[model samples]
Target: MPGNADTLTTIAALKSVSKRYGSVTAVDRLTLEIRRGEILALLGPNGAGKTTSVNLLLGLAGPTDGKAELFGRAPRDVAARRRIGAMLQGAQLGGHARVHEMLALYSGYYLDPLPRMETLRIAGLEGLENRPVVKLSGGQKQRLLFALAICGNPELLFLDEPSAGLDVESRRGLWAAIRRLKEQGRSIVLTTHYLEEADALADRIVVIHCGRVIAQGTPAEIKNTVAQRHIRCVTGLSAVQVKMLPGVTAVNSDGERLDIVATRPEHVLFEMLRLDPALQDLEVTGAKLEEAFLALTDDNREAQAA
Candidate 1:
């Protein structure tokens, strides 16, 4: 598959891009690319420069140094961005305008827009088109923003926290719509706070911290980076006894329950059964994306603080 490199023919590229305000650097020499027909997740903590990176791609802000490109052209070039669709963090819709009117207004801006009815159908707002925009719920408004973004049949989509403020059902609906877009071969760049969202939708995940790319890989690849297995078991062994097991790294307890954090889960469990002889419930799961995310970001923060 094509990557974020020049030779790889990515749809979007940031070459050593940086945005600085006096002594503060919002984005620091960042370089990444979103390839054609792939969903790439931009993962980061608060103040991790995720929004700054999106703005650079949208040409909403000029970089202090380096370049932001879309299909080998500058981001600000209207012709280059003609195939792009962008939905920023916060969108404002007219209070009194009907949903259909809002769709019509945005559709007019595009050179070749989808039919208003088709747009509403695609956004799952067919019956609600006559309703006022302000009367729509937060999730509905988000769906409307997504509808407008794709009205032009854009080849590239930029979604910043696209599922924010959406309920579980609305979120699932939006996810299905995104999958349909992907099936049509549209490339997507998504920024989401929900780790599961990224895990489910993104073909590749890129984690940024301290304004730089810290980790980049597939969901499984990122999760495996931690190389730690978590084991939850109901055993009669005490905390101190569990700690003495070979390869058991850390162990804690909550009175009647023992919580063991270890590098070798199998060895810990083996020892527990042999010693206690009455281990009841047991379950093993892989390291969560959130755990790896926190660890990766914390490492970057520590390095910066050092």
Candidate 2:
């Protein structure tokens, strides 16, 4: 659904793209698109070609086959490159550089950049603009990297693990800032291991595995792929007894409480209720993004093996 060529717009795309490193393929005919004014989360486990896909889009790596496009042109096109900003991991921000100064430097690279104060505000670096990069804490430095990335005020952004070093509060603050960017009609390609973050921010999610897309959909749609529901309750029924339920997949219990994963939650709940009339604090929740991710990737792997 991400590359729907109907009425929706596309900002960037990779058409049947492939990348190889010697004998091994890093990306295998991958097709992806960044939709306009949307937060698209590109998700995959470690070494799943996520970095390769981003590199191809950013023109940092040339594809072995097929094509990568930005603004409907070659990824390396100067004008197209200028319209995108990238915030990546392992960037070497010098210890001597101050926050505002670095922002000024990077902003100068673009034809029209965001104001220094605005960049600082968006990055949550306002109070630390004068602090040396080395003296700042890990989280503070992460914020500075984010500030530099947005200084150019690009129409599209590629964020790689943007909230890695942030605490809970700081991470939420950054998420809010990202939402504001989307509100301004800017498109973003976000790659994060935090499934909850993807669930919270992304309008669309693309899951890649073994160098190709395995699943792509909205958060709800993705979660729906896994029919496993979790039911937790305080009950007197033993774990063995609950596992005997017809639809129950697995059951874990700690004395008086039971945590059950089941395909037919209604049947499981009915049986549990009938078995343990004193059951309390019952909660039935849908599958989380992480659960769906694991199931999809594992299924992909199994299919390839077979």
CA error at residue 267 for candidate 2, angstroms: 4.6
Q: What lDDT would each prediction earn against the true structure? A: 0.81, 0.85
Candidate 2 off by > 4 Å: 1-7, 232-259, 271-291, 302-306
Give all TM-scores, in the order shown.
0.84, 0.84
lDDT of 2 by residue, 1-306 (tens): 334452178789999999999998999999998878889998887788888899999999999999999999998998997899999877867668887777888899999999999999998888898887878888888888888888899899999878877899999999999999988778899887666788899999888877899888997776555467889999888888889889776788776678898877998999888878888999998766566567677777788899
Candidate 1 lDDT (Cα, 0 to 1): 0.81
| Top-lDDT candidate index | 2
TM-score of 1: 0.84
Q: Candidate 2 has what TM-score?
A: 0.84
